[model samples]
Target: MWIESTLIAVFVMVLLLDWITLIVHCIVGVGLAWLAYSLTTEAPRLEHVTLIHLPIIFFAVVLGTLANYVTEVVRLEQERAMLATAGSIAHELRTPLLGIRSGAAGLRNFLPALLSAYQLARENSLPVVAIRRSHLATIEGVLERIETEANYSNAIIDILITNTRLPKLGHEDLSPCSMMRCIRIALERYPFSVDEISQIAPVTGNDFIFEGVELLMVHVIFNLLKNSLRHIAMTGKGEICIRAVSSSQCNQLVFRDTAAGIPSEVLPHIFKRFYSLPATGDNILGSGIGLAFCSEVVQAFGGTIECSSILGEFCEFSLKFPRIQS
Candidate 1:
């Protein structure tokens, strides 16, 4: 009987040891998994084997997700702070820029008058004949060009300010305008001209009258179109296609371009403020506010903007909006 009791005691001790080892293993696994997630760019995908660690793995995943969320929140806060600071500095600088531009324009306008007076004097007086009228004309032309450039700079600064200020949407009913029609209208208003409008199709959604800001939405579409055009123009032989389709629950508008596409490495940051891809060329103008504004507008309207591209083939952007229920 004593031997029997002794055997049972030994078995109980062994069972206790096994449970303790399992717990220790789980704690170790969770720590390692979390470390991996923290160090990598890729998201964590927990597997069935990971569940063998149970509560420990679950806590680790939760902690990892929380960590990621905190990181993003912090990043966004930093960006917001930077944007505010830059906007303030730009506002202060704009006053002087505007003054300079205005003075330059006034001087340019009076330059032609001054040249004409000089010519008249030269023609009227024998001693002044040595001053050639051509030299005076050249000086006037240079001043005019400088004034034109100053005006352009002021316009660019105005656009930057407009983009920095997040304007609220106007609650106006938008008619169910054809996606093609909207594209055509936006294109007409755009600064550049297109030889042809290719492969654009109709889309059904809330009429342009839906509750949103019409001008801002138009600006978003126009910006996307301009971006596509800029890329296609670079290729010298490319086209842009606009298409829209309505699924049961959502409506999608797609803009596809046949130009050399965006590189995969830069695709993710395309919508980020001031984040322009090097492959897009240094000469690409604008403050890199276009796509970022589009993203803001889409999100405001409860939609999403997504891009897909192949390095040498094509780039496509999809805008998805939830169908408005009557």
Candidate 2:
């Protein structure tokens, strides 16, 4: 009886999907029932009602009703499993990544000295041609890029952890912090080739301070750098110039890159969430939320970010934040 009651309830609930339709169905059913009662002197027989047809209708509706509930239950379970797995994976990854970063940092610190010693020994004991100048330069450049990419990868891992664990950005996270410090960290941690690194300019002022979450802003800057570097890499040569200066009421940071710039038609929609360029033959991949994320983060800090570009020439992003005096 309980099972039968549940089935009947499911049937009714399925039929009454919306208020307007439910009302119409209810009025129609009641009118038909009243007419049937008025016409029947004796109680209607099951034989005349056609039992086979009734069972088939009930069977189909009940099947769909239970299937809907089952699908919802499965979907919720899958979401819970995914969240748990993500947390576990982040924890597991952070440990090994920290070790790799430490090792790379150590190599970065001692690499120049090691290279110098090797050069001195080579000159003293062997012919200069034994170790070519171009080979040494290539090795140094490769090592530098490795170190830079290691730092960048660490920052990315940290961001992943933060995204998984941290709550939405709150007012407390927007306390006055050193903008110069964040910018410097972003530059150091951004993945750039040795050549691109050489072209970077210094911050214009010594007094750039702002109010925002340091970590999130770093990600914003990192995102911009990542996008620039990605397009630049496709061409195998590019230059990036970054400058930060204090204005009357705000501090402005300009990042300009001599890379394949965005198209005029595509530029307008670049900041839209999850809107990515179609994969052309070059295979420029993007999550599409990077620029959108940067825009949102800057807005959260009471700032503005704008981009200007000329295709095949350059792309420039200008960010302005209300200057907070120390």
Candidate 3:
């Protein structure tokens, strides 16, 4: 079926492209045939040009169509090859990334105790451990940065995997998830710089729980946070707020950021699949799948996601989920 549809599409495109020539050929062929019949026939003689124009029209239509079809076929084949290569590369990179993430987790857990022991030894005046407290503090800071970057890398990998897998959101195990807990975990996992950390919103109500695919909820929140941070980094200062509330029929989570808000013209298309915003000096081009993916996942979980923004002021994303009764 796909092959048949593709062939038909290729034919239609080729015909559209060569329609003018085809029309001219038909007119010429018919006119010459009429002239030839007028000249040669007893009733009306016909000219030899009829023979020339008829074959020309036939050959032009057939050969021109074939050329267009082959060109399209080759272009599609090249695109297919490129996509396959990209998929292969992504697959190869995931293994090493998983190992690095695990190692980083171990180091993050071990480094604190090691630092504390060094501090204790220094306080007791042990000669070998008498390093400056400032030096120890610096090492601790570096370790923290390492852990943060590692988490950031892993989150990026998760996004890539999600994009590649295009995970269908339904039929997963649904579990009761606390909005407040998910927000805290996403913040901890997100790679916020030292100064940016000060701007994070405090967790709100603890009772706002709902049934969801917990891992997916985390990724959705992380994507929102990551986008906000990227925009905020342009101005060197901004705030992100996550507020949760319950209404009569739904539980609402509003994620607002005082970053470079989306332009009015661009705002309407933000959730469109593969539609990226134009890149400016401060922002990198996006794959444009993040928000679309979020929308799909939300819908699959029987929820709705919406966004509102005012350029240069703020952007807000609101997610509403149907509350499940215990």
Best by TM-score: 3
**All-Cα superposition RMSD per candidate:** 12.5, 11.1, 10.5
Model 1, span 1-326: residue lDDT tens: 43345335434433443434434554675588579777894766766754554565345444544555666689779877766775676678777777877787788778778777877777788455465657766786776566555654554454445556666654353334345456666665554432535422333344322234555666677667667767767776566777677677777778887787888988898887878766557332333667888888778777799999997788999988777677
lDDT ranking, high to low: 3, 2, 1
Q: Output the number of the lDDT-best candidate.
A: 3
**CA lDDT of every candidate:** 0.64, 0.70, 0.71
Candidate 2 positional error at 274, Å: 2.4
Q: How far is candidate 1 from the true structure (C-alpha RMSD, Å)?
A: 12.5
Residue 154, model 2: lDDT of 63
Ranking 2 against 3 by lDDT, winner: 3
- Which ranges of candidate 2 are over 4 A from the true structure? 1-92, 95-152, 160-166, 191-193, 280-285, 323-326
Segments in model 1 whose C-alpha atoms lie over 4 Å from true places:
1-70, 126-137, 167-209, 225-258, 264-269, 272-275, 279-289, 308-314, 320-326
Residues 134-218 of candidate 3 have per-residue lDDT tens digits of 8877877775566667666656766655644545555455677887787778777776678778878775643577777777788
For candidate 3, the TM-score is: 0.59
Write candidate 2's Cα lDDT for 1-326 as tens digits: 43455456546756544434434554576479668876884665455335555565557455655665666689768745654565577668777777876776778789799889888888688554466788888877775566666666666655544433434666777788677788888887666656667656655655577788888878877777777877777766677777777878778878888888889998888876546876633221254456767888888888999999998999999989987755
| Residue pairs in candidate 2 whose N, alpha carbon or C atoms collide under 3 angstroms | none
Give the better candidate number (1 or 3) by lDDT. 3
